[model samples]
Target: MATKFALLLLALSPLVFANTASADTTNVLFLAGGRSHASGEHEFNAGCRLLAKALNEQSGLDIQATVINGWPEDQSVFKDVDAVVIYSDGTKVIQHGWERADQLAKSGVGLMFMHYAVHPSAEQGERYFRPWIGGAMETGWSVNPHWVADLKALPDHPISNGVTDLVRAYDEFYYNMRFQEDRDQVLDLVTAVPTRERLKRVINLWNQHGVNGIGKRQTLMWGIQREDGGRGVGFTGGHYHRNWAIDDYRKLVLNAIVWVAGADVPQDGVPSETVTEDALNENLDTYPKENPRIPLPNVEEFMQLPPATNVSMEDYENAKAAQKNRARKAKAKQLAK
Candidate 1:
């Protein structure tokens, strides 16, 4: 009877554990920044909502996703979250709540920063950002340029589960991040060679450092499993909100969110429905009437568009001046009306 009972318990253990695991739901919190940039650009709030919708309805996992505009005044919102994702302009969103964020990190809560959120002040980068997210965009060292990144390959990681095809997109992909001293802990999930020919526009902090980095293989997205048992991810390619329409681009980010939340990424990754044109335009921040709506890129045509020739500093400055003049004229015309 004792021998029979032992075998029966073994057979039931797998089922029991599976049930327990499935019952535990992962909660993901997205702290989206306030309105900034032009129309269809830095749609932080909109982007967060779209991603949250996918996690809740399409991920096929027991996950609850919430999006809070800016930092929550109520501190309790961070209490039960399995992971916190920040998509904003720099670390300004969490500037006042560093203590609380650190506490969460210590307690093994995952953290992720998208686009400009990864470019914190040097002091903050060394103190909090690097340790928490494995890497950050250091000013003078890193460069943000609008370029076509051919993410031709991905590492065999949970974050790369369903990312099977080439993810080619033109956006402000920041490169040459400052990583922690122990780089062995940081896992490079997505990397692309940023050649001069691929650069469309060299803006913000694009100096000699950026010019010298041409043809270098830069890590566009990365993940790290920290010593504290928490996870961290830094992705520098969320600049163009419209790029979310691309399947592979969207899947890569969705997969990272699930992975960082301490949940098992599905074998086929987090499945999300095809993002339609109407969906892309939804929840956009208010911009001037003169700012034209950005059209959804036809993936094939957009990807096939030839790379721009090398951009020079003089050319960039001239373009900036022209853009300013155009904006001024638009505002003047609006006033006349």
Candidate 2:
């Protein structure tokens, strides 16, 4: 009788452990990098790290967000990931065919594209994109501009779940996107209108792109439930990394990630801890502030200043990197809380 009781306990242990492990774990992969921009802007890696921190710490939901600076050198990183958020140049990242989009789609893995990540070159659009994300931002047909957009109304969707008063910011918004033809397959998440005064000012600029014919109401964000039961989202914002500091903006993004991850999005959206500017600066690309394109300074002349003075790009980076390291330690403390 004692041996039989012991065997039953051992058999039940595995089931109990499996249930606990599978219940709330939603794994996310954030792929970022590509073009460089000025200080505090277009910091894809840094933005992604901060986003991961917000999701892990702030969101009441249980999620594990991994920030990969670029596509992983090790393809195994793709294994078991519930969803993916790409925040880089679409063509550059997707060009090599390193990732198998079909397997992910077939497995119902979710996807989210932030900013320029929505546009893959015409060549690769149909092959990998159409089936994965529903559509790609085709050039010539698409008009991208850096303008402030007022998101007065949002469609009812899981991404918009828990959002009551949406906050609008002066971001580098790219409007006039050319989405999939069968509009019913995609659900509009955010509908925004560019500032009329600014739009009037940039008429010639808009016309310069041959924007003679464009729609006034723009759909800047959408959610796609593919026929294969996979999920996807495309957001044409995040050009200005600073926008992540806004609560509504962060909430919307967090919810989308959770929803696409095959998890239950909180009714109030993904709850993130209040993010600080210091936290935002963490894990930024160590590119020189003066020359955003180059990774480091070209001359010793700029490197002569005191470390704190930040007279040169490297000096600034050192200071910032040091600050970020401290912030990371603090992140561990936040998790403890």
Candidate 3:
């Protein structure tokens, strides 16, 4: 009877250990910047919330995601997180905490930056950003142009798991990044050729460098695995907040978040429910009265728009003047109030 009882206890030990291991959860932290761009453009806080909501409610994975506006007041928040995602203007959030962030990187925590967050001062770019994320948008070298990026192909990567079909969107996609010297260590996840026909406006940081690379392929999204067993990703296509309504665009980011967290991406990638116009409007930052609310695009209609072509310099100037006029009038109206 004693021998039989001992055998039963031994059999249940495996089940007990399995349950314990399965209960462990992965923690991801988001550092969102304050209001930066015009309404319906940056939306960093809202964007982070939307993404965190997806991971918490829709991802079907054991992920705990937290979003802190600007930088966290409590530095302890960084402790124990498996990954960190920054969606903000430039590198302001991590400006004062480079050492802390570097410690995280050295300890094998995953890091990712999106949109303008990928841009850092050249000094910081060389000192930290390039090594941390494999690349950074260098001023005088990189160009931010609003164009139709017809992402027709993706490399074979876990981040590309469920991302199928063409992901063409009009965004301020920055290219010509300054990457690490060891090009062999970087994985270009998404690349698209920027053609003269695909460009809509080439105003910011546009120069001889941008003009020379019009017909060449550029890396819009890239990833790297560091010697410390950490992972990093740089994405340059989150300029328009409304673009989040696109399924593939949202999924690719979701997949990256999971992959960076060291979690197993589902065979079909991290599943997320369709984003509605109502959902898109939630959690947006309050802007000045002059900045009118940009309407959320109807997913299907927006996707069906024809490929973009270069806007004539005259047309660009006219549009810029009209926008300024609207802002000036709106300012007067607010002052009257």
Q: Using Cα atoms with residue i matched to residue i, what is each candidate's TM-score against the true structure?
A: 0.84, 0.77, 0.83
Provide the global lDDT of candidate 3 against the true structure: 0.84
**Candidate numbers sorted by TM-score from highest down:** 1, 3, 2
Model 1 pairs in collision: none
Give the alpha carbon lDDT tens digit for every residue of 214-263 in model 1: 88888898888987999999999887888988888899999999999989
lDDT of 2 by residue, 216-307 (tens): 66777777888777798888888776677777788888887888888887777788776666666566666544433313211233223222
- Over 154-180, each residue of candidate 3 has an lDDT whose tens digit, in order, gives 657888888777687778889899999
lDDT of 3 at 158: 86
Q: Quick one: best lDDT, which candidate?
A: 1
What are the runs in model 3 whose C-alpha is more than 4 Å off? Answer: 1-23, 290-294, 298-337
Could you give me the TM-score of model 3 versus the true structure?
0.83
lDDT of each: 0.86, 0.69, 0.84
**Which number leads on TM-score?**
1
Of 1 and 2, the candidate ranking higher by lDDT: 1
How far residue 178's Cα lies from its native spot in candidate 1, in Å, is 0.8
User: Which should have the higher lDDT, number 1 or number 3?
Assistant: 1
Worst 10 residues of 1 by lDDT: 302-311
